[model samples]
Target: MKKSPIETVLGILVILVAVSFVHYAATKIDVRPQDGYTVSAVFLKSGGLESGADVRISGIKVGSVTGLKLTDDYAADITMTIRDNVKLPKDTTASVASDGLMGGKFLLLEPGRAKEKLNDGDKITKTKDFKSLEDMIGDVIFLATDSGDK
Candidate 1:
């Protein structure tokens, strides 16, 4: 059976749309750091922290930010999903850090020496946020002018 030219064009258009939809869905999915337990941390200030931000250890990405919310006390709570193979110590620290002078934000994890390990839903008690560039510059200026030799 011979198909009409209009039918052929419609079929091609349908296939193109399907392919485009698949590509869009795949790009939106976050498929890194395979399924693992989640840990929570509280920060005085998240400082532009958002879901999908990279979680790193010593500058190496080990996980990603899974969620963010505010606690009853007004502190920001961030949930991170880390790889199953990476077992964080009980005393580990989580801090919000920036990539560089011009880069996005991420979580920095520093493991501490502890016999115990953190379980799912465990909260990291220690955290540090990135300092504003203005604040940093002001501190440097103050130190430079406050020297006794000045």
Candidate 2:
């Protein structure tokens, strides 16, 4: 069978479009951590958190989640890279949070006013555990049913 010139042109056009789309997608996903220092925090629940998630402070992204692991005590050990200029205090707290009910997860930082500063590799001691919607519903149901138990 002999192929037409138009068919050959269409095939090359499709390949070019696919390559361009792949390059666009690759550029949009900026997951590589910027130049920064790393610190860790332990959370009882990861709450669907994933690596490359944004780390935000007061609604502004200042870092990113670099690693996630399971600790010896069965907790979620999260490592994050924070911007060099954003120095956190020893009393700063980290929490796994979501943007909204239908949105993705992020690590929220609440910096505390301490004279001392946290150094690289220091583990944050204060952290708020992630609470899922099911947990909140269970708590409500328990209170509603246990009102007369005691």
Best candidate (score: TM-score): 2
lDDT string, candidate 2, 22-73, tens digits:
9999998775648888999999999989988999999999999999999899
TM agreement with the true structure for every prediction? 0.74, 0.78
TM-score, candidate number 2: 0.78
- Model 2, residue 12: distance off in Å is 15
lDDT of 2 at 142: 92
Candidate 1 local accuracy as lDDT?
Answer: 0.89
Candidate 1: worst-modelled 10 consecutive residues by lDDT: 28-37
Alpha carbon RMSD to native, model 1: 5.1
Regions of model 2 farther than 4 Å from truth: 1-32
Query: For candidate 1, lDDT tens digit of each residue in 46-137?
Result: 88888999899998878889999999999899999998999999999888888787889999999999989999999998788667677799
